[model samples]
Target chain A: MARNLLRAAAALTVATLVGCAAPSLQVAEMGSFHVGGRTVTLSGLPAKELVFTPGAPPLKLDPNGDFEVEALYARYTRLSNPKAKFPLLLWHGGGLAGTTFETKPDGQPGWENFFLRAGYDVYVSDAVERGRASWARYPEIFKSEPFFRPKKEAWELFRIGDTDSYATDPARRRALPGTQFPVAAFDQFATQAIPRWGTNDAATQAAYDAYVDKVCPCVIVVHSQGGNFAFNSALKYPQKVKALVAVETSGSPNPDTYDFSRVKGVPMLWVWGDNLGKFAFWERIAAQQEKFRNSLVRAGGKGERIVLPEIGISGNSHMLMMDRNSDQIAALIDQWLARQGLRN
Target chain B: MARNLLRAAAALTVATLVGCAAPSLQVAEMGSFHVGGRTVTLSGLPAKELVFTPGAPPLKLDPNGDFEVEALYARYTRLSNPKAKFPLLLWHGGGLAGTTFETKPDGQPGWENFFLRAGYDVYVSDAVERGRASWARYPEIFKSEPFFRPKKEAWELFRIGDTDSYATDPARRRALPGTQFPVAAFDQFATQAIPRWGTNDAATQAAYDAYVDKVCPCVIVVHSQGGNFAFNSALKYPQKVKALVAVETSGSPNPDTYDFSRVKGVPMLWVWGDNLGKFAFWERIAAQQEKFRNSLVRAGGKGERIVLPEIGISGNSHMLMMDRNSDQIAALIDQWLARQGLRN
Candidate 1:
C-alpha cells in the first residue's frame, strides 16, 4: 500500500509539475492526532445563553459536563524515503506551541522545514494546554488560573533585551547589542505566547509521556521548558528514546534527586546560543542544565554541549530556532546527528 | 533568491534520493503569524504562588497586566510553483482549529494535503480564541465565560449519530446508519473541540475580516460555523474573494437582514453531507443556509449547492472532511474549482 501511494504520488507529481519546480521533499504520509488526556466532569456551574452567530437565537450554554482537556496534539510528516534512522520530534517551550519549530517570527522557514530537508520524518507537537492541545477550565481541571506571558516579560526573560530595555513603545524597546533575534518582528513573536498554567507540569509530563510512548524509538529536540519533559521522558523510557537534543533548556531534573544513569546510553546534545551571561536568570538556568548534563556524562553517558560563541557563532538569543542564523544552528545539529549515526 | 533556493533544493534532492522516492511536492516558502488583535490592560486581580515545576519553589503569579489577546493565527505553505491562480485560505469552524483540515480523526491525510497536492498554496487559520489564537480572560476582555463542547453534543449535533443514539459507553454508542464518519474515532474527533465563547462573534468576525484583508485576492474554503465569517468577508471584500467553498456551514446571514448583491460577482459552492435531515437542528441550519444561497442566486450571484445524496454520493456525516469518503469529497471540490477557473 505504501509503495502504491508513492507511485501514485510520483505520477501526480509529474502531472502537477507542468510549470512548477520539482517538490523539495516526497512525503509518504502526513497526519495529526491528540493523545493523552483524561476526562473530567464538572457540575454546578451556571448555564447561560450563547449567541453563536449574530442575529441567530441563543443556544443554551451548559457548563456542567464531562470535558476532555490536557491532551497533547501532534502533527507528523513522513518522507517517502526517509534518510534518518528515526523520526524527529520538535517540542516547543513555555507559553508556545509547536509553531516554535515552524515558521520563524520573521517569516523565514523554521527548523521543522530545515530538518525535513535534511531527511528526517518530522513531528511537531503542542504540549498539554498549549495551542491545539486545548486548555481546561482554569481552577477546575487545572489547579490554578492560567497565567499570561506579557510582551515585556517575553522580551526581558527571553534574553532579547536588557532588564530595563523593554518599553511600552516598540521604537524604545532595545534589543541586546548584536542580537540575532528579529527585533523588528518582536510583536509577531509575542503573538505566539499563550496562557500557561503554573500547576499543570504533572499533566504536561503525563501527556508528553503518552506522546513519547505513542511515537518513539525516535529523536526529541526540545527547547526551554520542554527540556524537563524530554529529560524525564528519556529517563522514563530510555529504550524508546534514541537521542536527546536540548536547546537552551530553561529547567532540568535536579541532578542530586533524579537518576541520570538511565539516559547514560542515550546520545545527548545540548546547544546554547550566544549572550547567555547578560542575564543572571539565563545564567542560573544554564548552570542547572549543565549540572544535569555533567551528571549524565559522569554516569558514563555520551553528551556534548555546544555554546555557540565557543564555536565562533555569536549574538543568538533564547529563541535560537527563530534567530537570523537559525539555519546555521540547525546545520550544526544536523552534523552532530550525522556523527551520532542518526543518518541513513 | 527563490531560484537559488529552488536550485539548492534540487541539488539536495538529487543527493538525498539515493534510495528514496522523489518528494511529492516542492515547497518554496512556509511561515505563520498572528494577526488582528488589540492589546488590553487589566488590574486589581489577585496574585498567587505558582508551582511551575515539581520540586521548585513557587513563583509569584501576578494577574495584573497588559495582554495581547483575541488574535487570529494562520500558517501558510506556498508551493515552489503553485498551480492555482490564487492561494487557498482554509478557515475552520467553531470549537476547532485549522487542524480540522489537517489530519482526520482516523489518521488520514485531509483536505489541506488534498488541495496542496492539487497545486494550491494553502493557508490554514485558527480564528479568534481558537487553537493557536489564544483566548483572553473571560468576563474581562471577553464578555462571557468560554463554553466547552461535550462529546455527546458533538455526536448528535454533528450528524454522526441519531439524536438518541449517544451513549456514555463507547461500545453502546450508535452511529447513524451508513454514516461515513469513522465511528470508532468519535472520541478522537472530540479532542479537536476546544472552549468556545458565547459573546465573541464580533471579535471573531473582526479578526477574520482583518485576516481577509491581509490574505485575500484568494479562494476560501470554510466549514461549519466559519460560514458566517466567509459570507461576511465576501460581502465586505467582494473583489478579494475569488471563490468560496462552504462545507456544512452551520449558520448564515439572515437573507432578510443582509444585502446579498455584494457577493454577486464571487462564485460560491455550498456542500452538504448526507444525514443532515436526520435531526431538526441540522434541517434548520441547512434551511437557513439554503435560504442565504437562494438569496445569493436571486441577486444574480453564481452559487451552487451540492447535497451529497443528490449527487449520488451518500452516507456522509456533517464532518465530511473527516469522513471515510473525504478524499472523494475533496476531489469533487477540486473538480469544481477547476471548472470555476481557479486552477492555473
Candidate 2:
C-alpha cells in the first residue's frame, strides 16, 4: 500500500510536466528517400530458402542469391519558407520506424510536418533491420532471433502509464494523470512497435554511421534508444553535426571513453518529460544522463538540459514528439536550434 | 515487480477508455444563478461567535446567533432556448463541490456552460458542508476530523497516471500514453480537492434529499461518491427525478434494501471510463454497480450502462466531466436525454 501510494505520487509528474505554447508556421512540402544498405555474398555451399503464399505454389531458392543487410529508409519533408540553415534528420529509437516523425496514430500531423512548417526540411529515417529497411534471415548474416516487445513491456518501459494499466480486465487500466500522449490512439502507437535484437547493434551502428555520412552538416533529432547512435555519430564526425537534440533518449556515447574534444564545438540539447525521479527505470536513466551531461560539461563542452516542467509545460510522457502538443514542442525546438545557430 | 506490472497494466484503462463524439451545436446563450441555504435555531444557551480581522479589533456576535447546517449551495445556469424538457441538476461526488460543473481547471468551459448552451437550465450544486455550503465547527454541528485528499491519492484514485508521474523530479513524471485530462492545469484541479469525512454521509444525504425536494422533476447528473445520494433520492421520490446520469460514481444504493419498484419509471444511465478492472478499488465499485444495475433491471427498470471504450469513445479518465472533450460527452448525454424523451 505504501508502495502504491508512492507510485501514485510519482505518477503526477507524468501529467504536469511537458507542454508547449503554439505554432508560427505550417508545412509546405513532404517527400521520402532511402539510404545505406549492403549486399553480403555467400561463399559456402548452396542453402535452400522457402517462400510460402496463400493458395499458391511455394517457391524454393538456392544460396546463389546474395542477402541485402543494414539498409536505412528515410522520408523528407521540406518547408517552402526555408528558414532553417540546413535539413534536420530525425532518427528513431530501437523497435520503431520513421513513422515516429510522420502522421500521428490519431490522424494528427507528426513532428516531420511541424518542423517543415516551422521552416526546416525534415528527414525521418528507419534504422537498419527496422521499418522499411527490412531484416535479413538469421544464421546467414544475423546471429540471434529477433524479440518483439510485449504489450506489457511497451506500457511500462515506454512509461505509457503503469503496468496494471494493460490488464486484461479493461477496468483496471488507470492512466497516470496529465499524460499528453493521445492514449486513445495508443493502438496506433503500438502498431509502430516492431521486432528488435540486442545483438544487431554492430550492424545497426554501421548503417547509422553510413546515414550520418550521407546527411552530414545537418541538425539531428534522436529519441529513446537512439541517443547512443546520435551521440557516437556526432562525436565520430563533429564537423557533420551542427546540433544534437536528444528526446528522452535511452543511451549515450560513453563520456569516459569517447573523444569529448570532437564534440566540443557541437551544441547538444537533452530534453526530458515530467516524473523522472519516481519510477526506478526513469530514475536510473535520468541519473546516467545527468552524469553524462556533467562529464561533457567537465570536458568543456556546451549543452543544455531542458526539463519540461521547468519551462511551465507539464504532464508530458516520453513520446513528447508525438504528443497533442507536438507542434508546440517542435516550435520550442526550432527556437532552441535558432539559439544554437542551426536555424535561421 | 509483478505488482508493479499489474499497476502499470491497470493504469492504461484510465487513459484510453471512455470518450464522446464532437458536439453538433455550440451553446448560444449562457448565464448563472445561486441558491439553497438555511440557519439552525438554538433554544437553551446563548449562541455567540467572534470574528477576527487582520488589522482591527475582533467583532463579537450576540447570544441570539444560530448555526447553519445541511444547507446546500446551488448555481443555476439557465438557457434561453430551453430545449430540454426538464431542468438538469448536477451533483458532485465526495470531497468535491459544485465547481465540478463550472469552468474547467484547464481554462476550458465546464459542463454547466455546455448543458446550458445545449438548452437545459443546469443546476450545479455544492453538497452540504462542501464548497459554498460551508461546514460548521466540529463537536457542534459536525463530527470527527475531516481528511484531505493528498495530491498523490488524487493522481492514483482519479486514474490520472502512475506514481512516478507525480514525483518532484521533473524528469520522472510521465503522463500515461493517452490521457486527455488538461494535465497542464492539474494544480487548478487539485484546488478543488477539499476536506471530507466519512461520518458526514447522513447530513449530506439529508441535504441532498432536501435540495431534490426543492427542485423536483429534473434530470440529475451525479458523479463519483454522489451516486449514492442520487440513487436513494430518485428511489425515495420517483416522480421527482426525471432521469439520472451517473458518471464514474464510486458508490450506489444497495438493491437488496431499496424498493427497486420505486425507481422503475426513472430511467438511469451509468457511465464508466477505461480500466475499471485494473484497480481493485474501481473494480469493486464497477462490480457492485453492475450488480445494482442487474437488480434494477430485474425490477423492470430501464437503465443503460455506457462503457466508453465499448462504445468506441476512448482515452477518458475517471474525471470525464473535466476532460478535454468534456463538451462532447455533454452532447452525448444530451443525445441520451433526447432518447429518453426528456429533451425537446
Taken over the whole model, the C-alpha lDDT of each candidate is: 0.83, 0.68
lDDT of 2 at A81: 65
lDDT of 2 by residue, B4-87 (tens): 334334433322222123222221211121223344444354433332223445333322223334556554534435789899
Best model per lDDT: 1
Q: iRMS of candidate 2, one decimal?
A: 28.6
| lDDT (tens digit, per residue) of candidate 2 on A152-206 | 5566667668755664332565666887888776644654555565567767777
Task: Tell me the tens digit of each residue's lDDT in model 1 across A205-286.
Answer: 9999999999999999999999999999999999999889999999887889878777887999999988788888889889
Worst 10 residues of 2 chain B by lDDT: B25-34
Measured by TM-score, the strongest candidate is 1
**Colliding pairs, model 1:** A23-B25, A23-B26, A24-B26, A25-B23, A26-B23, A26-B24
